[model samples]
Target: MAKWGEGDPRWIVEERADATNVNNWHWTERDATNWSSEKLKELLMGLWVEGEEGKCEITEVSKVE
Candidate 1:
């Protein structure tokens, strides 16, 4: 099983989660400018379960341009 840092854009399907330093994410890739942060924020914020409120962490994201 391999582990990825917070700077990583993807995670492997490992049996366990590994910890890594991400103080500097300069190695991280950038998405296209066509993507709208506001729209994405709105969509992610809509993950509420209504009657059953909960929070989720975004482990993955992508952009098409």
Candidate 2:
């Protein structure tokens, strides 16, 4: 192991006044609920499937949760 003050720089955590994540290395939280719901609805709606004498279509996506 390297000595206390001679360790690799990448392993060191820099001091910050706000104590935020350094270099965005940590996991950050984001709210995507509305965006994901809309995206799912857009992708699911208007889909159609046909096989032999059967056919089905997704005309509307009411909820995605």
Model 1 regions lying over 4 Å from their true place: 1-35, 48-65
Work out the TM-score per prediction.
0.21, 0.61
Cα deviation at 64, candidate 1, in Å, is 15
List ranges where model 2 is wrong by over 4 Å: 1-10, 13-24
Best candidate according to lDDT: 2
Q: List the residue pairs that clash in candidate 2.
A: none
Find the 10 residues in a row with the least total lDDT in model 2.
21-30
The Cα local distance difference test for each model comes to: 0.50, 0.83
lDDT tens digits by residue: candidate 2, 1-65: 87768878887765579979866678676899999999888888888999999999999887787
